[model samples]
Target: MENSSPLVLMLLGAALMLCLHPLQAQIDGTGLFHDYYAKSCPKAEEIIKSIVEKAVKKEARMAASLLRMHFHDCFVKGCDASILLDDTSNFTGEKTANPNRNSVRGFDVVDNIKAALEKACPGVVSCADIVTVAARDSVVLSGGPSWIVPLGRRDSRGASLQGANQNIPAPNSTHQTLETKFKLKGLDVVDLVVLSGGHTIGLSRCTSFKQRLYNLTGNGKPDPTVDQGYLKQLTTLCPQTGTDDNQTTPLDLVSPTKFDTHYFKNLESGKGLLITDEILYSTKGSKTAALVKFYASHSQAFFQQFAKSMIKMGNITPLIKPSGEIRKNCRKMN
Candidate 1:
């Protein structure tokens, strides 16, 4: 009741929430599993980033793989631990885009972790766990989702390319559309706003967002009030020329590779990198805007909500108990 002590009520509510969602019961490893997963994620991310760092260094095409994996999985059936597979079973490409995002070479760093874990723990850890840990670490490493959840979410043995395509929102989707999609995943409108914080890293091809500068007019373009100089920069980077330029911008312009409040500020300042990013502040997503306000005002609040959302998102139809096997290789059926 509103009349009850807020602190006592808060404890009661959290206890109820944990009871209703028994995933917390899975964290009985004295935090060792949590620590192991957290510690290993950086190592995996260093490898993934080292690969991307080369692209930054050589001005080469950045591998869209690691980020691609997260988007593909989360969008499909609410991050259902399926994208960690390289085989074709349990899912179909027509339903998800897992295959398309499966750029083997880019995930070599994660592969390194699997191999190391294989030696250190030998089949104790799953590729699903790898992707889950990698997703969080990837966020921290490249600048997004700051907390780490448990790593015992076992790897599944099926990869569904169609699943990715069906679930992942097209870069140009409207804020209203994205909210519905996230809602279907058991996440609220605010979850989509926060989950998309993944955009803080990675690059989107011109084809994905070019509709703004070259086509859309007036408010159809993101932040219609956004500076013309900035618009011109994206056009130049993307090039309307015969060839496509992969001109990518950091979603969080301030600390492109660090997870922070810059994303919320960007939305308020009209500097969100993608059309979808900016739309959350628009009419269709005023609630999302409210969340941005909360996140900006209370850092701890945002982190806590973000962590819970990650857990909810990760638990979608998980390969619970003995439901699936951990694949030996993430690229193909073993």
Candidate 2:
């Protein structure tokens, strides 16, 4: 009986480990695992989380910016930190891409995280993994669901200026265009609706959606789908002319700094801040409209699906060891 009890305990321990680190089994196939740095850099995720928390504390909007960085990076070149590269004399980077130019902020925070990680672990952690982990931490700090990020991604040697401009869905993207863009990345409609929830904690510049408030569809009238009061509010914040295009407003007026279902709720009431945002609920016979309604009514469901979708997005064509190098500096190839 004593021997049997010991064997039983051993089996239970194995089961517990499997449950705790399910992605560990994929380290061989996908070259990613929940504990990819368990031996190489035990404090990789901890270091990232701490830096992200400090950045978000200083500026709540930074949480969304960091999260957006991950999305933009992954969409451009499979989340290998290609978006982090800066243009040099001989090369152009994605920073100047139409979708990214002056829009994607938080590079300084990423550089800070990278500097700290490089100091602690040297070349053990890659900037790609740091960006991915920082993104998850940003969401958690903003009151969103937490998920285990599969790590071990390496950095790309080059940035894709063309891919950055073409791949990312714009604020004026149609529902079909958005879905097609996501599909190209192996994401489906569910991923689209849930991932769009990321706007819940961020702000959008006036230029991104100003047309919705004035001259949508080239007409001198605002988008009829926007609620009358919301249209008035947006117009005041984003005037037709002589307004700074860089002026920003909360993407989710209900709870802009906190990650929640308010984005979905706002969509239901026609207060969605972006044309792309409103399209999810306002487009005629949109498959996304049902999803927006479902998520609006089920906050927990939105949170859970969001975590799953993020994990899926993080897995897009990662460059594992031997395929790419670990970049010491995120801004330029090392």
Candidate 3:
């Protein structure tokens, strides 16, 4: 046979990868069902909801933290709970990654839910599924739309610190960067916009968006996309020297405690906290800009899309059947 063309080789390589990682096709919920745990652990989601409800009642921000944990966990390694791993002698965990360290919280909440599930139905529920359920419950508790989460995800045996750092979109990521990051995860522009709405309730540390307040583009100027009034407030809260990294501000200043369309409204008014958030609106002629506007005007549309997108996100490359283990401790390999 004649030598294969470069295009043919590329197509063959893509096909081979799909065969090797068949779970990648599951992002659309191919092998997953909404009640995958109904028989194995009937009370699995209920247990998670109870714990998350109490936690959020005690501290409302916990809802956002839990939601963020799910996002971080999924983006790094296909929602496999690699972000939940703790550093060990043999491996460094994703927890220490630049995007996650001091940012992603709610591991204890996951632990609490896992312990409850273990008591109720030992070894039946996976920590990965626990995080997924907690995320759904967190949204519902925080006044966001809820969806039936498909289960049967298993925990990975390894962590990917590098993947966490490189894959998770940073607070300073550009519009193109955010789009590419979501696309790499089998998500689309709509997914990116709707998922970003999760920011409507979360708290972002000063470190996450200090550049927008201080030295954007190393020019020693605030991001012009930021509202001048909001910039003044941010400068007062976050200093020009940028020392208070641990200090947090709500990602959505309009209605920080509620998971609503205010985040898109903030973007429209140049009040978005992070460059990544603001760019969704400021990126001229971008599809994301249009989506932001649409969501801002029609919250019902945003809520519906958010629920659908979240389900799609939860389905990212789950390890089914005998592929991964049901971890006893979410932070350690089984």
Q: Pick the candidate with the highest TM-score.
A: 2
How accurate locally, in lDDT, is each candidate? Answer: 0.59, 0.91, 0.88
Model 2 segments beyond 4 Å from truth?
1-24, 27-29
- Writing each residue's lDDT as its tens digit, candidate 2 over 157-230 gives 99899999899998899888999999999999999999999999998889999988888898788899999998
Better model by lDDT: candidate 1 vs candidate 2:
2
Q: Global lDDT for candidate 1?
A: 0.59
Q: What TM-score would each prediction reach against the true structure?
A: 0.72, 0.94, 0.90
Provide the lowest-lDDT 10-residue window in model 2: 20-29
TM-score, structure 1 vs. true:
0.72
Ranking by lDDT: 2, 3, 1
lDDT of 1 by residue, 209-274 (tens): 677776665454444744477677777787666764455556566666555677777767766677
Top-lDDT structure, candidate number: 2
In candidate 1, where is summed lDDT lowest over 10 consecutive residues?
28-37
User: TM-score-based ranking, best first?
Assistant: 2, 3, 1
